[model samples]
Target: MKKTGLFFGTFNPIHIGHLIIANHMAEFSDLDHVWFVVTPKSPFKAKQTLLGDHHRYQMVLEATQEYPKLEPCDIEFKLPQPNYTIDTLTHLQERYGDSRQFALIMGEDNLNGFHKWKNYEAILEYYQLYVYPRISGQKIAEALKDHPKIHRVAAPVMEISSTFIRREHKAGKNIRPLLPESVWRYMDEMNFYR
Candidate 1:
Protein backbone atom coordinates (compact mmCIF):
# COMPACT_ATOMS: atom_id res chain seq x y z
CA MET A 1 0.00 0.00 0.00
CA LYS A 2 1.18 3.49 -0.77
CA LYS A 3 1.64 5.70 2.27
CA THR A 4 0.16 9.17 1.86
CA GLY A 5 0.47 11.96 4.40
CA LEU A 6 -2.45 14.34 4.90
CA PHE A 7 -1.13 17.77 5.82
CA PHE A 8 -4.17 19.72 6.98
CA GLY A 9 -4.22 23.53 7.13
CA THR A 10 -6.25 26.63 6.34
CA PHE A 11 -3.35 27.94 4.18
CA ASN A 12 -4.80 31.51 4.01
CA PRO A 13 -2.00 31.86 1.49
CA ILE A 14 0.41 29.10 0.64
CA HIS A 15 3.85 29.90 2.02
CA ILE A 16 7.40 28.57 1.67
CA GLY A 17 7.35 27.13 5.20
CA HIS A 18 4.33 25.01 4.30
CA LEU A 19 6.11 23.75 1.18
CA ILE A 20 9.34 23.01 3.01
CA ILE A 21 7.62 20.96 5.71
CA ALA A 22 5.58 19.01 3.18
CA ASN A 23 8.73 18.29 1.18
CA HIS A 24 10.51 17.17 4.32
CA MET A 25 7.62 14.88 5.25
CA ALA A 26 7.63 13.31 1.80
CA GLU A 27 11.40 12.90 1.54
CA PHE A 28 12.30 12.01 5.11
CA SER A 29 9.27 9.97 6.07
CA ASP A 30 7.61 6.82 4.68
CA LEU A 31 5.01 8.90 2.79
CA ASP A 32 4.94 8.45 -0.99
CA HIS A 33 2.91 11.63 -1.45
CA VAL A 34 1.97 14.54 0.77
CA TRP A 35 -1.47 15.97 0.17
CA PHE A 36 -2.09 19.55 1.29
CA VAL A 37 -5.65 19.30 2.58
CA VAL A 38 -6.82 22.88 2.23
CA THR A 39 -9.57 23.30 4.74
CA PRO A 40 -12.53 25.52 3.91
CA LYS A 41 -13.43 26.27 7.51
CA SER A 42 -11.84 25.11 10.69
CA PRO A 43 -13.86 24.80 13.85
CA PHE A 44 -11.18 26.37 15.97
CA LYS A 45 -10.37 29.28 13.66
CA ALA A 46 -12.21 32.47 12.84
CA LYS A 47 -14.07 32.12 9.52
CA GLN A 48 -14.23 35.90 8.97
CA THR A 49 -10.45 36.04 8.66
CA LEU A 50 -10.24 33.32 6.01
CA LEU A 51 -9.91 33.99 2.32
CA GLY A 52 -12.31 32.21 -0.05
CA ASP A 53 -11.81 28.45 -0.13
CA HIS A 54 -11.39 28.39 -3.90
CA HIS A 55 -8.71 31.07 -3.70
CA ARG A 56 -6.81 29.24 -0.98
CA TYR A 57 -7.06 25.98 -2.94
CA GLN A 58 -5.87 27.65 -6.12
CA MET A 59 -2.88 29.21 -4.37
CA VAL A 60 -1.94 25.80 -2.95
CA LEU A 61 -2.15 24.27 -6.43
CA GLU A 62 -0.02 27.03 -7.92
CA ALA A 63 2.57 26.79 -5.17
CA THR A 64 2.85 23.02 -5.37
CA GLN A 65 3.03 22.73 -9.16
CA GLU A 66 6.76 21.97 -9.20
CA TYR A 67 6.62 19.17 -6.65
CA PRO A 68 5.37 15.91 -8.10
CA LYS A 69 4.76 14.46 -4.65
CA LEU A 70 2.87 17.48 -3.32
CA GLU A 71 -0.85 17.66 -4.13
CA PRO A 72 -3.49 20.16 -3.09
CA CYS A 73 -6.73 18.42 -2.18
CA ASP A 74 -10.27 19.85 -1.99
CA ILE A 75 -11.86 16.85 -0.32
CA GLU A 76 -13.24 18.91 2.54
CA PHE A 77 -15.03 21.28 0.16
CA LYS A 78 -17.48 18.53 -0.74
CA LEU A 79 -18.00 17.56 2.87
CA PRO A 80 -20.16 19.32 5.47
CA GLN A 81 -19.15 22.70 6.84
CA PRO A 82 -17.08 23.09 10.06
CA ASN A 83 -14.87 20.24 8.89
CA TYR A 84 -13.65 17.68 11.38
CA THR A 85 -10.48 15.71 10.90
CA ILE A 86 -11.99 12.39 12.03
CA ASP A 87 -14.84 12.62 9.55
CA THR A 88 -12.49 13.51 6.69
CA LEU A 89 -10.16 10.65 7.51
CA THR A 90 -13.05 8.22 7.75
CA HIS A 91 -14.33 9.30 4.37
CA LEU A 92 -10.88 8.96 2.85
CA GLN A 93 -10.36 5.49 4.34
CA GLU A 94 -13.66 4.30 2.94
CA ARG A 95 -13.02 5.84 -0.43
CA TYR A 96 -9.44 4.59 -0.82
CA GLY A 97 -9.89 1.27 0.97
CA ASP A 98 -6.67 -0.72 0.85
CA SER A 99 -5.28 0.97 -2.21
CA ARG A 100 -3.57 3.57 -0.03
CA GLN A 101 -2.56 4.05 3.56
CA PHE A 102 -3.15 7.51 5.02
CA ALA A 103 -1.15 9.12 7.77
CA LEU A 104 -1.60 12.46 9.53
CA ILE A 105 1.11 15.11 9.24
CA MET A 106 0.84 17.79 11.91
CA GLY A 107 2.85 20.20 14.01
CA GLU A 108 3.66 19.31 17.61
CA ASP A 109 1.50 22.28 18.72
CA ASN A 110 -1.52 20.57 17.18
CA LEU A 111 -0.70 17.41 19.09
CA ASN A 112 -1.03 19.40 22.29
CA GLY A 113 -4.64 20.09 21.43
CA PHE A 114 -5.36 16.67 19.98
CA HIS A 115 -7.64 15.63 22.75
CA LYS A 116 -10.07 18.44 21.99
CA TRP A 117 -10.83 17.16 18.51
CA LYS A 118 -13.80 15.01 17.70
CA ASN A 119 -13.02 11.31 17.94
CA TYR A 120 -9.47 12.19 18.85
CA GLU A 121 -8.76 8.78 20.33
CA ALA A 122 -10.11 7.07 17.25
CA ILE A 123 -7.75 9.14 15.13
CA LEU A 124 -4.85 7.99 17.25
CA GLU A 125 -5.94 4.38 16.94
CA TYR A 126 -6.48 4.37 13.19
CA TYR A 127 -3.85 6.64 11.63
CA GLN A 128 -0.18 7.17 12.30
CA LEU A 129 0.81 10.74 13.16
CA TYR A 130 4.02 12.27 11.78
CA VAL A 131 4.73 15.21 14.08
CA TYR A 132 7.16 18.00 13.26
CA PRO A 133 8.56 19.98 16.16
CA ARG A 134 7.22 23.43 16.99
CA ILE A 135 7.93 26.02 19.64
CA SER A 136 6.31 25.16 23.00
CA GLY A 137 5.58 21.57 21.92
CA GLN A 138 8.07 19.81 24.13
CA LYS A 139 5.61 19.26 26.96
CA ILE A 140 3.02 17.65 24.71
CA ALA A 141 5.69 15.54 23.06
CA GLU A 142 6.86 14.23 26.40
CA ALA A 143 3.34 13.23 27.37
CA LEU A 144 2.79 11.29 24.17
CA LYS A 145 6.32 9.98 23.93
CA ASP A 146 5.23 6.42 24.57
CA HIS A 147 2.44 6.39 22.01
CA PRO A 148 3.20 3.67 19.46
CA LYS A 149 1.59 5.38 16.46
CA ILE A 150 3.27 8.76 16.82
CA HIS A 151 6.47 9.32 14.85
CA ARG A 152 8.52 12.42 15.64
CA VAL A 153 10.04 13.93 12.52
CA ALA A 154 13.21 16.02 12.46
CA ALA A 155 11.90 18.54 9.93
CA PRO A 156 13.24 22.06 10.48
CA VAL A 157 11.04 24.32 12.55
CA MET A 158 10.47 27.42 10.48
CA GLU A 159 9.44 30.44 12.55
CA ILE A 160 7.48 31.85 9.63
CA SER A 161 3.71 31.93 10.07
CA SER A 162 0.75 32.69 7.81
CA THR A 163 -0.50 35.12 10.44
CA PHE A 164 2.82 36.94 10.34
CA ILE A 165 2.83 37.01 6.55
CA ARG A 166 -0.71 38.35 6.40
CA ARG A 167 0.10 40.95 9.02
CA GLU A 168 3.13 42.08 7.06
CA HIS A 169 1.18 42.30 3.82
CA LYS A 170 -1.57 44.28 5.50
CA ALA A 171 1.08 46.68 6.81
CA GLY A 172 2.35 47.14 3.22
CA LYS A 173 5.55 45.29 4.03
CA ASN A 174 7.13 42.85 1.59
CA ILE A 175 6.15 39.24 2.26
CA ARG A 176 7.80 37.75 -0.84
CA PRO A 177 10.29 35.78 1.20
CA LEU A 178 7.51 33.93 3.03
CA LEU A 179 5.72 32.68 -0.08
CA PRO A 180 6.38 31.12 -3.47
CA GLU A 181 7.12 33.69 -6.14
CA SER A 182 4.05 32.76 -8.16
CA VAL A 183 1.81 32.90 -5.11
CA TRP A 184 3.35 36.20 -4.10
CA ARG A 185 2.50 37.65 -7.50
CA TYR A 186 -0.99 36.24 -7.34
CA MET A 187 -1.59 37.81 -3.93
CA ASP A 188 -0.26 41.14 -5.17
CA GLU A 189 -2.22 41.15 -8.45
CA MET A 190 -5.38 40.19 -6.64
CA ASN A 191 -4.82 42.67 -3.76
CA PHE A 192 -5.19 40.04 -1.09
CA TYR A 193 -4.83 40.72 2.62
CA ARG A 194 -5.31 44.45 2.11
Candidate 2:
Protein backbone atom coordinates (compact mmCIF):
# COMPACT_ATOMS: atom_id res chain seq x y z
CA MET A 1 0.00 0.00 0.00
CA LYS A 2 1.31 3.44 -0.80
CA LYS A 3 1.50 5.64 2.29
CA THR A 4 -0.15 9.01 1.91
CA GLY A 5 -0.64 11.99 4.21
CA LEU A 6 -3.87 13.94 4.30
CA PHE A 7 -3.34 17.57 5.23
CA PHE A 8 -6.80 18.99 5.86
CA GLY A 9 -7.59 22.68 5.99
CA THR A 10 -9.95 25.33 4.74
CA PHE A 11 -6.91 26.77 2.94
CA ASN A 12 -8.73 30.11 2.71
CA PRO A 13 -5.60 31.13 0.88
CA ILE A 14 -2.81 28.58 0.67
CA HIS A 15 0.44 30.14 1.89
CA ILE A 16 4.12 29.27 1.95
CA GLY A 17 3.86 27.85 5.47
CA HIS A 18 1.28 25.35 4.27
CA LEU A 19 3.52 24.48 1.34
CA ILE A 20 6.56 23.94 3.59
CA ILE A 21 4.67 21.59 5.86
CA ALA A 22 3.12 19.56 3.06
CA ASN A 23 6.32 19.31 1.07
CA HIS A 24 8.24 18.31 4.16
CA MET A 25 5.79 15.50 4.85
CA ALA A 26 6.05 14.27 1.28
CA GLU A 27 9.83 14.32 1.17
CA PHE A 28 11.00 13.84 4.76
CA SER A 29 8.37 11.58 6.23
CA ASP A 30 7.24 8.05 5.34
CA LEU A 31 4.42 9.41 3.23
CA ASP A 32 4.82 8.91 -0.53
CA HIS A 33 2.50 11.81 -1.28
CA VAL A 34 0.93 14.64 0.68
CA TRP A 35 -2.56 15.63 -0.31
CA PHE A 36 -3.92 19.01 0.66
CA VAL A 37 -7.56 18.17 1.37
CA VAL A 38 -9.42 21.44 0.94
CA THR A 39 -12.19 21.43 3.49
CA PRO A 40 -15.55 22.93 2.56
CA LYS A 41 -16.30 24.10 6.08
CA SER A 42 -14.68 23.79 9.47
CA PRO A 43 -17.03 23.10 12.34
CA PHE A 44 -14.63 24.80 14.74
CA LYS A 45 -14.12 28.05 12.87
CA ALA A 46 -16.36 30.94 11.85
CA LYS A 47 -16.07 31.78 8.17
CA GLN A 48 -14.63 35.29 8.11
CA THR A 49 -12.69 35.66 4.88
CA LEU A 50 -13.67 32.20 3.62
CA LEU A 51 -13.49 32.37 -0.15
CA GLY A 52 -15.53 30.05 -2.32
CA ASP A 53 -14.53 26.38 -2.09
CA HIS A 54 -13.45 26.17 -5.73
CA HIS A 55 -11.35 29.31 -5.37
CA ARG A 56 -9.37 27.94 -2.45
CA TYR A 57 -8.94 24.62 -4.28
CA GLN A 58 -7.77 26.52 -7.34
CA MET A 59 -5.20 28.35 -5.24
CA VAL A 60 -3.92 25.04 -3.91
CA LEU A 61 -3.67 23.63 -7.43
CA GLU A 62 -1.65 26.66 -8.56
CA ALA A 63 0.61 26.61 -5.50
CA THR A 64 1.34 22.88 -5.69
CA GLN A 65 1.67 22.49 -9.45
CA GLU A 66 5.47 22.35 -9.31
CA TYR A 67 5.61 19.61 -6.69
CA PRO A 68 5.14 16.13 -8.11
CA LYS A 69 4.62 14.57 -4.69
CA LEU A 70 2.20 17.21 -3.46
CA GLU A 71 -1.45 17.05 -4.57
CA PRO A 72 -4.59 19.14 -4.05
CA CYS A 73 -7.71 17.20 -3.07
CA ASP A 74 -11.30 18.38 -2.93
CA ILE A 75 -12.75 15.25 -1.38
CA GLU A 76 -14.67 16.97 1.38
CA PHE A 77 -16.32 19.36 -1.04
CA LYS A 78 -18.66 16.63 -2.23
CA LEU A 79 -19.38 15.49 1.28
CA PRO A 80 -21.90 17.09 3.62
CA GLN A 81 -21.11 20.33 5.39
CA PRO A 82 -19.41 20.35 8.81
CA ASN A 83 -17.21 17.47 7.64
CA TYR A 84 -15.32 15.55 10.27
CA THR A 85 -11.96 13.82 9.97
CA ILE A 86 -13.24 10.39 10.76
CA ASP A 87 -15.91 10.61 8.10
CA THR A 88 -13.50 11.88 5.49
CA LEU A 89 -11.02 9.14 6.26
CA THR A 90 -13.75 6.57 5.91
CA HIS A 91 -14.77 8.06 2.61
CA LEU A 92 -11.22 8.10 1.34
CA GLN A 93 -10.74 4.48 2.25
CA GLU A 94 -13.83 3.59 0.30
CA ARG A 95 -12.81 5.62 -2.71
CA TYR A 96 -9.15 4.72 -2.84
CA GLY A 97 -9.54 1.22 -1.37
CA ASP A 98 -6.80 -0.76 0.35
CA SER A 99 -4.16 0.22 -2.16
CA ARG A 100 -3.39 3.42 -0.22
CA GLN A 101 -2.64 3.92 3.45
CA PHE A 102 -3.74 7.36 4.55
CA ALA A 103 -2.53 9.32 7.53
CA LEU A 104 -3.44 12.66 9.03
CA ILE A 105 -0.86 15.47 9.08
CA MET A 106 -1.56 17.84 11.93
CA GLY A 107 0.07 20.51 14.04
CA GLU A 108 1.33 19.90 17.56
CA ASP A 109 -1.21 22.36 18.93
CA ASN A 110 -4.12 20.31 17.59
CA LEU A 111 -2.79 17.25 19.40
CA ASN A 112 -3.62 19.03 22.63
CA GLY A 113 -7.30 18.95 21.71
CA PHE A 114 -7.37 15.84 19.56
CA HIS A 115 -9.46 13.98 22.08
CA LYS A 116 -12.28 16.45 21.60
CA TRP A 117 -12.77 15.55 17.96
CA LYS A 118 -15.71 13.35 17.03
CA ASN A 119 -14.68 9.69 16.93
CA TYR A 120 -11.14 10.75 17.60
CA GLU A 121 -10.50 7.47 19.36
CA ALA A 122 -11.67 5.58 16.32
CA ILE A 123 -9.48 7.76 14.12
CA LEU A 124 -6.39 6.93 16.17
CA GLU A 125 -7.31 3.28 16.26
CA TYR A 126 -7.54 3.08 12.49
CA TYR A 127 -4.96 5.48 11.09
CA GLN A 128 -1.55 6.96 11.79
CA LEU A 129 -1.13 10.64 12.60
CA TYR A 130 1.93 12.61 11.43
CA VAL A 131 2.36 15.50 13.90
CA TYR A 132 4.46 18.49 12.99
CA PRO A 133 5.93 20.95 15.49
CA ARG A 134 4.16 24.25 15.97
CA ILE A 135 4.87 27.22 18.23
CA SER A 136 2.13 26.68 20.79
CA GLY A 137 1.77 27.25 24.52
CA GLN A 138 -0.51 24.24 25.01
CA LYS A 139 0.73 20.84 26.06
CA ILE A 140 -0.06 17.68 24.11
CA ALA A 141 -2.70 15.44 25.65
CA GLU A 142 -1.28 12.71 27.84
CA ALA A 143 -3.15 9.99 26.00
CA LEU A 144 -1.97 11.22 22.63
CA LYS A 145 1.51 12.30 23.62
CA ASP A 146 2.77 8.74 23.64
CA HIS A 147 0.40 6.99 21.28
CA PRO A 148 2.08 4.36 19.14
CA LYS A 149 0.23 5.51 16.05
CA ILE A 150 1.39 9.12 16.29
CA HIS A 151 4.62 10.04 14.50
CA ARG A 152 6.12 13.37 15.44
CA VAL A 153 7.94 14.87 12.48
CA ALA A 154 10.73 17.43 12.98
CA ALA A 155 9.52 19.76 10.28
CA PRO A 156 10.08 23.52 10.34
CA VAL A 157 7.96 25.49 12.77
CA MET A 158 5.93 27.72 10.50
CA GLU A 159 4.51 30.67 12.35
CA ILE A 160 2.71 32.07 9.34
CA SER A 161 -1.08 31.84 9.19
CA SER A 162 -3.71 32.71 6.61
CA THR A 163 -5.62 34.84 9.09
CA PHE A 164 -2.58 37.05 9.69
CA ILE A 165 -1.89 37.43 5.99
CA ARG A 166 -5.50 38.34 5.28
CA ARG A 167 -5.59 40.84 8.15
CA GLU A 168 -2.37 42.53 7.05
CA HIS A 169 -3.39 42.72 3.40
CA LYS A 170 -6.73 44.19 4.36
CA ALA A 171 -4.85 46.82 6.38
CA GLY A 172 -2.90 47.86 3.25
CA LYS A 173 0.22 46.03 4.37
CA ASN A 174 2.31 43.95 1.98
CA ILE A 175 1.94 40.34 3.04
CA ARG A 176 3.26 38.88 -0.20
CA PRO A 177 6.36 37.36 1.32
CA LEU A 178 4.26 35.08 3.52
CA LEU A 179 2.69 33.35 0.50
CA PRO A 180 4.05 31.32 -2.43
CA GLU A 181 4.76 33.56 -5.41
CA SER A 182 2.06 31.93 -7.53
CA VAL A 183 -0.48 32.11 -4.71
CA TRP A 184 0.52 35.69 -3.87
CA ARG A 185 0.17 36.78 -7.46
CA TYR A 186 -3.16 34.99 -7.78
CA MET A 187 -4.49 36.67 -4.66
CA ASP A 188 -3.14 40.01 -5.87
CA GLU A 189 -4.77 39.66 -9.27
CA MET A 190 -8.04 38.63 -7.71
CA ASN A 191 -7.93 41.65 -5.36
CA PHE A 192 -8.53 39.32 -2.43
CA TYR A 193 -8.39 40.51 1.17
CA ARG A 194 -8.29 44.11 -0.05
Candidate 3:
Protein backbone atom coordinates (compact mmCIF):
# COMPACT_ATOMS: atom_id res chain seq x y z
CA MET A 1 0.00 0.00 0.00
CA LYS A 2 1.17 3.56 -0.70
CA LYS A 3 1.53 5.84 2.35
CA THR A 4 0.69 9.51 2.13
CA GLY A 5 0.02 12.17 4.74
CA LEU A 6 -2.16 15.21 4.19
CA PHE A 7 -1.00 18.25 6.13
CA PHE A 8 -4.15 20.29 5.93
CA GLY A 9 -3.95 23.97 6.84
CA THR A 10 -5.37 27.31 5.73
CA PHE A 11 -1.79 28.32 4.93
CA ASN A 12 -2.82 31.97 4.60
CA PRO A 13 0.72 32.19 3.38
CA ILE A 14 3.07 29.27 3.75
CA HIS A 15 5.79 30.17 6.22
CA ILE A 16 8.90 28.61 7.68
CA GLY A 17 7.01 27.37 10.70
CA HIS A 18 4.64 25.40 8.50
CA LEU A 19 7.59 24.04 6.52
CA ILE A 20 9.32 22.94 9.74
CA ILE A 21 6.26 21.05 10.89
CA ALA A 22 5.83 19.38 7.47
CA ASN A 23 9.53 18.48 7.38
CA HIS A 24 9.31 17.00 10.85
CA MET A 25 6.28 14.90 9.89
CA ALA A 26 8.07 13.66 6.74
CA GLU A 27 11.14 12.67 8.74
CA PHE A 28 9.27 11.02 11.60
CA SER A 29 6.23 9.48 9.96
CA ASP A 30 5.83 6.84 7.22
CA LEU A 31 4.50 9.47 4.79
CA ASP A 32 5.84 9.32 1.23
CA HIS A 33 4.57 12.83 0.55
CA VAL A 34 3.09 15.60 2.71
CA TRP A 35 0.40 17.45 0.82
CA PHE A 36 -0.41 20.92 2.09
CA VAL A 37 -4.16 21.14 1.71
CA VAL A 38 -4.67 24.86 1.13
CA THR A 39 -8.11 25.49 2.45
CA PRO A 40 -10.15 28.14 0.57
CA LYS A 41 -11.99 29.09 3.70
CA SER A 42 -12.09 27.64 7.17
CA PRO A 43 -15.53 27.35 8.69
CA PHE A 44 -14.21 27.91 12.19
CA LYS A 45 -12.37 31.11 11.49
CA ALA A 46 -13.48 34.69 10.94
CA LYS A 47 -13.39 35.19 7.17
CA GLN A 48 -13.41 38.94 6.79
CA THR A 49 -9.67 39.23 7.13
CA LEU A 50 -8.70 36.11 5.21
CA LEU A 51 -6.55 36.52 2.13
CA GLY A 52 -7.76 35.42 -1.30
CA ASP A 53 -7.49 31.65 -1.71
CA HIS A 54 -5.48 31.75 -4.95
CA HIS A 55 -2.94 34.19 -3.54
CA ARG A 56 -2.48 32.02 -0.49
CA TYR A 57 -2.22 28.94 -2.71
CA GLN A 58 0.43 30.60 -4.88
CA MET A 59 2.45 31.50 -1.80
CA VAL A 60 2.32 27.88 -0.66
CA LEU A 61 3.57 26.80 -4.08
CA GLU A 62 6.56 29.15 -3.85
CA ALA A 63 7.40 28.12 -0.30
CA THR A 64 7.29 24.37 -0.84
CA GLN A 65 8.87 24.24 -4.31
CA GLU A 66 12.34 23.28 -3.05
CA TYR A 67 11.16 20.53 -0.72
CA PRO A 68 10.47 17.27 -2.55
CA LYS A 69 8.58 16.01 0.48
CA LEU A 70 6.06 18.86 0.38
CA GLU A 71 3.40 19.29 -2.29
CA PRO A 72 0.92 22.15 -2.16
CA CYS A 73 -2.53 20.71 -2.73
CA ASP A 74 -5.61 22.60 -3.90
CA ILE A 75 -8.01 19.69 -3.61
CA GLU A 76 -9.92 21.54 -0.92
CA PHE A 77 -10.38 24.51 -3.24
CA LYS A 78 -12.13 22.24 -5.70
CA LEU A 79 -14.30 20.90 -2.90
CA PRO A 80 -17.12 22.83 -1.24
CA GLN A 81 -16.21 25.90 0.75
CA PRO A 82 -16.49 25.61 4.54
CA ASN A 83 -15.67 22.05 3.49
CA TYR A 84 -15.81 19.19 5.96
CA THR A 85 -12.70 17.07 6.37
CA ILE A 86 -14.71 13.85 6.34
CA ASP A 87 -16.21 14.71 2.95
CA THR A 88 -12.80 15.59 1.51
CA LEU A 89 -11.32 12.35 2.82
CA THR A 90 -14.13 10.35 1.28
CA HIS A 91 -13.62 12.05 -2.04
CA LEU A 92 -9.87 11.50 -2.01
CA GLN A 93 -10.19 7.83 -1.06
CA GLU A 94 -12.55 7.15 -3.92
CA ARG A 95 -10.39 9.11 -6.36
CA TYR A 96 -7.24 7.20 -5.43
CA GLY A 97 -8.86 3.81 -5.35
CA ASP A 98 -8.04 1.17 -2.69
CA SER A 99 -4.27 1.10 -3.03
CA ARG A 100 -3.39 4.28 -1.14
CA GLN A 101 -3.71 5.11 2.55
CA PHE A 102 -3.82 8.73 3.69
CA ALA A 103 -3.22 9.97 7.20
CA LEU A 104 -4.58 13.28 8.44
CA ILE A 105 -1.98 15.48 10.10
CA MET A 106 -3.12 18.03 12.66
CA GLY A 107 -2.08 19.88 15.79
CA GLU A 108 -3.12 19.19 19.37
CA ASP A 109 -4.97 22.51 19.57
CA ASN A 110 -7.49 21.10 17.13
CA LEU A 111 -8.41 18.28 19.51
CA ASN A 112 -10.86 20.27 21.60
CA GLY A 113 -13.13 21.16 18.71
CA PHE A 114 -12.60 18.04 16.58
CA HIS A 115 -15.75 16.40 17.83
CA LYS A 116 -17.70 19.29 16.33
CA TRP A 117 -16.63 18.28 12.84
CA LYS A 118 -19.31 16.79 10.65
CA ASN A 119 -19.22 13.02 10.61
CA TYR A 120 -16.26 13.17 12.97
CA GLU A 121 -16.57 9.56 14.07
CA ALA A 122 -16.50 8.29 10.51
CA ILE A 123 -13.35 10.27 9.82
CA LEU A 124 -11.60 8.64 12.73
CA GLU A 125 -12.83 5.24 11.70
CA TYR A 126 -11.35 5.33 8.22
CA TYR A 127 -8.28 7.57 8.19
CA GLN A 128 -5.29 7.46 10.53
CA LEU A 129 -4.59 10.81 12.25
CA TYR A 130 -1.12 12.10 13.06
CA VAL A 131 -1.24 14.97 15.55
CA TYR A 132 1.55 17.35 16.39
CA PRO A 133 1.85 18.95 19.83
CA ARG A 134 0.04 22.27 19.84
CA ILE A 135 -0.56 22.45 23.55
CA SER A 136 1.05 19.39 25.14
CA GLY A 137 1.81 15.82 24.12
CA GLN A 138 0.12 14.19 27.10
CA LYS A 139 -3.08 16.14 26.61
CA ILE A 140 -3.21 15.22 22.94
CA ALA A 141 -2.69 11.54 23.62
CA GLU A 142 -5.30 11.54 26.35
CA ALA A 143 -7.85 13.29 24.21
CA LEU A 144 -7.28 10.99 21.24
CA LYS A 145 -6.94 7.76 23.23
CA ASP A 146 -10.35 6.51 22.16
CA HIS A 147 -9.22 6.44 18.53
CA PRO A 148 -6.87 3.58 17.73
CA LYS A 149 -5.73 5.27 14.50
CA ILE A 150 -4.64 8.51 16.18
CA HIS A 151 -0.92 9.02 16.83
CA ARG A 152 0.30 12.09 18.74
CA VAL A 153 3.78 13.23 17.80
CA ALA A 154 6.22 15.62 19.49
CA ALA A 155 6.95 17.99 16.57
CA PRO A 156 9.01 21.07 17.41
CA VAL A 157 6.64 23.98 17.94
CA MET A 158 7.55 27.22 16.23
CA GLU A 159 5.65 30.03 17.90
CA ILE A 160 4.83 31.75 14.62
CA SER A 161 1.53 32.43 12.94
CA SER A 162 0.26 34.01 9.73
CA THR A 163 -1.83 36.40 11.82
CA PHE A 164 1.33 37.77 13.42
CA ILE A 165 3.00 38.13 10.06
CA ARG A 166 -0.01 39.83 8.53
CA ARG A 167 -0.13 42.27 11.38
CA GLU A 168 3.54 43.08 10.82
CA HIS A 169 2.97 43.53 7.09
CA LYS A 170 0.03 45.89 7.68
CA ALA A 171 2.21 47.83 10.07
CA GLY A 172 4.97 48.12 7.42
CA LYS A 173 7.38 45.90 9.29
CA ASN A 174 9.70 43.29 7.84
CA ILE A 175 8.04 39.88 7.47
CA ARG A 176 10.94 38.16 5.72
CA PRO A 177 12.22 36.51 8.89
CA LEU A 178 8.82 35.05 9.69
CA LEU A 179 8.34 33.42 6.27
CA PRO A 180 10.35 31.27 3.91
CA GLU A 181 12.62 33.39 1.69
CA SER A 182 10.82 32.34 -1.47
CA VAL A 183 7.41 33.20 -0.04
CA TRP A 184 8.74 36.51 1.21
CA ARG A 185 10.09 37.37 -2.23
CA TYR A 186 6.89 36.36 -3.96
CA MET A 187 4.80 38.36 -1.52
CA ASP A 188 7.04 41.37 -2.01
CA GLU A 189 7.05 41.07 -5.76
CA MET A 190 3.30 40.73 -5.90
CA ASN A 191 2.76 43.44 -3.23
CA PHE A 192 0.35 41.27 -1.31
CA TYR A 193 -1.45 41.81 1.97
CA ARG A 194 -0.28 45.41 2.13
Q: lDDT per residue, candidate 1, 108-146, as tens digits? A: 888878989999889999999999988873477465777
lDDT for model 2, on a 0 to 1 scale? 0.93
Report backbone clashes per prediction.
0, 0, 0
Error of 2 at 70 (Å): 0.4
Model 3: worst 10 consecutive residues (lDDT sum): 135-144
In the predicted model 3, the residue pairs found to clash are none
Q: Write down the TM-score for model 2.
A: 0.98
The 0-to-1 C-alpha lDDT of every candidate, in the order given, reads: 0.93, 0.93, 0.84
Tens digit of per-residue lDDT, candidate 2, span 38-139 = 998898988665999888999999999999999999999999889999999999999887699999999999998888899998999999999999998898
Model 2 segments more than 4 A misplaced: none
